[model samples]
Target chain A: MSDNITKGKMIKPENLVYTKSRVMTDNVTSYCPGCGHGTAHRIIAEVIEEMDIQSEIIGVAPVGCSVLMYDFLDLDIQQAAHGRAPAVATAIKRLMPEKFVFTYQDDGDLAAIGTAETIHACNRGENIMIVFINNGIYGMTGGQMAPTTLEGMKSSTSPYGRDVATMGNPLKMTDIVATLPGTYYVTRQSVQKPANVRKTKKAIRKALEYQKLNRGTCFIEIVSNCPSGWKMTPVESNKWMEDTMFPYYPLGDFKVPEED
Target chain B: MERELRLMKGNEAIAEAAIRAGADGYFGYPITPQSEVLEYLTMEKPHERTGMIILQAESEVAAINMVYGGAACGKKVMTSSSSPGISLKQEGITYIAGAELPCLIVNVVRGGPGLGTIQPAQSDYFQATKGGGHGDYKLIVLAPASVQEMADFVELAFDLAFKYRNPAMILSDGAIGQMMEKVWLKPQKERSREFPEWATTGKTPDRERNIITSLNLDPNKQEDFNHKLQAKYREIEKNEVLYEEFQCDDAEYLFVAYGTSARVCQKAIELAREEGIKVGLLRPITLFPFPTVIISRLADQVKGILTVEMSAGQMVEDVRLAVNGKIPVEHWGRMGGIVPTPEEAVENLKSKIIGG
Candidate 1:
């Protein structure tokens, strides 16, 4: 852990540690208190702040709970239609090749309705990063079953638990995208804990660095939590995600560059 | 001081003119009758020449969303599609309108309620002039009847689109899109690096972060934004009504049409004059601004009005509404991709308006 990020009572000029990332605005987020979106949002801000490329970034926010991501991040953002963020990001990057462009999308937006867009944009090898969040259930739409929902997991639509025969199996999208030659880097991480949060931030930073190489697409899937949708407390959701979600979606790099 | 004349199809003319108009990007899916647009762009390699970004998107939906992405940055972006493809693009089109982004959308019309035919039809008049998407939004719809108009309206559409910060559509049909005519191509204009103040170029220390979004969850705020859009539309209707009158002076009958039907109606007017019938044609260039006032004024002088269309009488409703019973208004149309001939059109005008 960094020694500067301490909770101790050391209030000196050099010892001062706690302040919000300047990339994050003062506006209150609309996410549930225990939702991992806030952490994911904070990590994004921290990474952008630390990278010092705040002015060079252009983001496309997806149509989900994080649709208002632009409201929190102090960067130019375009809110996209459901599942079309990657296509939107594709245009932005193609037109402004010099700018750092990315798409912030959730499981429903990535693997379900926008499957064609996601695959084609990735296939095109657009020099952009896709910051994907996989939260098993559709949190914004009252815990409906999402494409990435774990088999046998109960949701509002899958009230009797997801039947693999009828509902299809959970899509390992990170693995699927990793197989694409267009992807330069593909990783699946989580933010259920502080350590995982750090790892995720590092992955995002690496994705941005790889983005500068102009090789291909960089995809980072954050297997996050939705406590309110999961009908669990934040702590319980973390344990459940570690137990159920991680087994199905392991946190690791699926694809890496030959050198990096 | 010589014009560079080229024999081009409407679809090709649009693609060439877009490059000459300094359009920044084009994202389109290849559909019938309009595939030539994407084909021409791909062949021309406009990116290598004019630095225009052209992409063959996976679907019409993705293409329109890509247009949204570019237009968000104040880029002169456009896409061309046929009827079914335009239906697929409605979702993205609504979002672009709701966000008040500027872009050009070209609908090279083919017949369809559902894959009806590959032939020319004006069935989408209701969809285009009226709200095609779910909102109180209207695209600045331009009816390009000729290859020359197809070439000219590319720059005109972008100008109006950027001026009003709204989407503009070039509503051409398969007849016009596939028909070949000589077009005087414009000189190449340089693409701009300067973006608009509201464009999402990037938030620097100099300005606040720019957001291009349609979502205003607050009902009160959404209502206020809707009012603002309506006001903008009203201003457009007041100032941007464009139409052409052919033989309307001292005429007793009016033929209201646009696009392919207008071309047919012009011939019908000549055919009627040969039969000692006094007829004129009022062709609406801007279908949304609609030439409503002129049609209403023309109603006072005309004995009756006939809206000649390729569809089963869609624009007739608007004509009847504009006339408001001051004069009889009737619709003569042929569905399933049938383009009514001049003789048949005059015959319908004679029976539907003069006799009925």
Candidate 2:
């Protein structure tokens, strides 16, 4: 009956209200409990507000959960077709080289359907920021197995768990993106803990700042948890992210160009 | 002001005309009958310090996409290719149309269904007017019948495109694309419109970021978007329809043609005059707006009409619809890379009007 236990609980009324620390508008959050998209969105919004680039920043929203981000962000936003955010962003930034352009994409959007566009944009060293969200499964499409689905992870499509031998190994986009010379900054961060959220915010801020200064492509991959799809409670989902996904997709900077 | 006159091929005229028209960039691929466009751009060095970019793209798709990129930045950009190469550019064309960006595309059409031949043909009439790509869209299709119009309409096409914020296509065939003709070039001193405030130029210290996009998820909002596009098309149709009348003042039989076929029709008009047959030509300069009003008026005076094209009868359908069954509109064409000569056109017109 106390505030602390009920606060983070699913039935808690106060937990429904979003954190005022973020720049999101009064739009209702559609994410479920322990869904990492909310945490990632909050961190990005806070970073934008802190950097004071909200007026000049343009964000490209993907076709997944973040597709409705234009309604939430109080900045200029373009909604790209599924997985075509990179191509859209590439054109936008190329046309207006001085704008701070960035794209927010999910694992399926970035690693699967939009792989060609994503890789080419990075390879071209387009001055833009990319915040990739890897939740290990397609949350919007009813827990379908995704390109980043971890081996032995159970989902609606993979009821017996993902098998590496037959389904292929989980794609590590950060590692693949790090190998491209056009990428000036590449990092992977998780949002499991308060300290990690702070770190992720700092990384997001740094990437945006790099793009603002006309430094080349900057990528930040956030390993998030999806409790409803993971078939676990909010607390268990957070623990699972720390215990399982973090070890495989280790959180840290993979590449950073020399400081100007 | 009169400039130096040169006997140039249609493709070369377009390339030179674009430079003289103050085109800031030319991104194109080399294809048959259209290679002269690229060749002229490369060989004739325009002043380079002002940044006139002319890059031979790896493919037609890349060229049109580059045009899209440059046009998005408020630059005067253009590209040219033959029919086969133009097929590769349709996707980019659709994107450019969806984004509502202003650019110019030149297609020197050849005989087709597929790589049919490099010879002259008007097979691309349907593709030019009926929205080549998926979706309900229309490009301002300019059919240039001679090298003079080839030089003249490049500037006009750019002006109309920028005026309407839509892509404009100068649809020609291999005959007009390759034949030598005299042209007087004039410089395009200023753009028809100032770059809009909403162009995707970078944000200044005081302004918010600008985004160019075609996404509208809300059904009502998308409906409004379609409505606005249709309204723009209506305005363009009212103001941009261009056609030429040749001795149609008191003629009873009229010949309808466009692009290269129109030139042949002109010669046919001269031959029919000698034969004591009152035959006149109605040539459309802008094919999309179709000059339906002219056909409607001509149908009142003329007893019959002959559509002389180099391909299977395409524009004849439009003429038939325009005449509304009042007059008999017949089609005569020679397909698969064959050019219907002036004599053939006159013979068809005589048979249709005199025989009927």
Candidate 3:
């Protein structure tokens, strides 16, 4: 039976394969099962290749699971300290305005520790892209509560569900960022289904395109999943994302500028 | 062609000089008297079709880091602030120095122990010459007296920064930054110097990955890094010592000063000369490679050397070290933004020269 499975074709539960390849390799990701980061990475890599701006692109990796993204992506990568990716990317884009620069940040890194850098970078109208991953919990640091964690979501730190009176409410970063005129593009997308993944790929592509055109600041928030931290299986996590997360954090573009 | 100069403030001169020097970018935060630098840049349309980038950063820390990023890519970048702001930029300054990136940093120094008065002071003399940041490093510190030198030294600072691939500083004071004079701006020249291919401007086919980092984990490798930096310092000291002398031919007393103090000392020397006392001034332009040999030679001919400054005797230490007790070296200064008048400096010089 094992021989039969090997002879024909066997798609493993943990393995993911994409059609188009850019600089990112086909190695199995270090993310846990049902992790949405792998999907987001694949979409960004595909968009980079599609735009054909790989050579002139620079990516800043923030501290978290994505800290070692330099190894995965074959672009000029700079590692920024926790929550400092926006500040670093601001410098890179300002210096080499012709280069397509972006940062991949986690919720804990952006909303919690690096709030000032993110807000100011957007306010300054830095012509760079930000791919913010909001997984509701700190996946790399043993599943701690994050700034974007839902009010009732329990984690290692908040073993008794996230009490808003004590831990504060979930931060709406996309809505906040949309208020800034410097922000040219702001959107929130998910990766629970293939249709949503396709839409997310388009959103990511649009942000990269805006950067290429040197329009202004572009931001995309990905409401990602962490099955390991959520204490659910891969299938159940996907179901939970649709049932629980979508209602609170509706997915769609929050701001799209009209050409004058 | 030599042109007549108009009077201008030192900070205003810096702004005009940066424009005339074809500086590609200016990232600065406003502080005290140095606000004129930012104000001038904002008023001037330097970035219109000239490819110049001017930004007012959120803080001094952000401004210097922005300069580091721009300089890393081979752009002519600069930033200016006062003492407190300069303190916030030490981390980024150390990184730029460690990477051997070329950039200019201007410090319009003010009194400071902790949020001290915004008045003029030379309290940052030790911080400027002796590495302001952590680790082993040195900035080419240029002290300018007149508004002309303030304008002239900006161009010179850029030259030295690019030549040595290190951060260069123009250390001035509030009197120089705020006082107005006439200045004739010179024509800007296109920089033709080529940077090493190792600068992180992205990879060409010929070179390996160019990493601009200060991290060294291994002890042996760190030692080698230190040795290389020392060699660079020695080369700089040999080639970059700059100073000016006034009426030292047959003088009995020598007045050692720099920056704003030098200007006051020059007036004092004239007054002393009228009083039948042969007094001369030796003003150092480059404070880091402190004009040691010149002071040593002057010590042989002079009876005593009086070091005058706006702060409590910082450069006097260097003067004593240079003279090495051969001649009695004395110092007098006013702290907390008070400029020592020519009368005060002349009186102090008279006491040191005659009373001794």
Q: TM-score for all predictions? A: 0.98, 0.80, 0.81
* Per-residue error (Å), model 3, residue B151: 1.7
Give the winner by DockQ. Answer: 1
Kept native contacts, fraction for each prediction: 0.87, 0.13, 0.11
> DockQ values for all predictions?
0.87, 0.19, 0.23
Task: Using DockQ as the measure, name the better of candidate 1 and candidate 2.
Answer: 1
* Interface Cα RMSD, each model: 0.6, 4.5, 2.8
Q: Candidate 1 regions off by >4 Å?
A: A1-9, B1-3
Write candidate 3's Cα lDDT for A1-260 as tens digits: 68887745655644546565655765677788878888888888888888776667777777777766665665666656567678767877876787888889999988988787789889988999999998888988989999999999999999999999999999988889999988999999998799999999999888888887888889999998889999999889878877888888889889986751
Tens-digit lDDT string for candidate 3 (B226-285): 889888888888899999999999889999999999999999989999999899999999
User: What is the number of backbone collisions in each predicted candidate, taken in the order shown?
Assistant: 0, 0, 6
Clashing pairs in 1: none
TM-score of chain A of each: 0.95, 0.90, 0.91
Q: List the residue pairs that clash in candidate 2.
A: none
Top of the candidates by lDDT: 1
Put down candidate 2 lDDT per residue, B151-174, tens digits, no spaces: 999999998988888999999999
Docking class of 3: acceptable
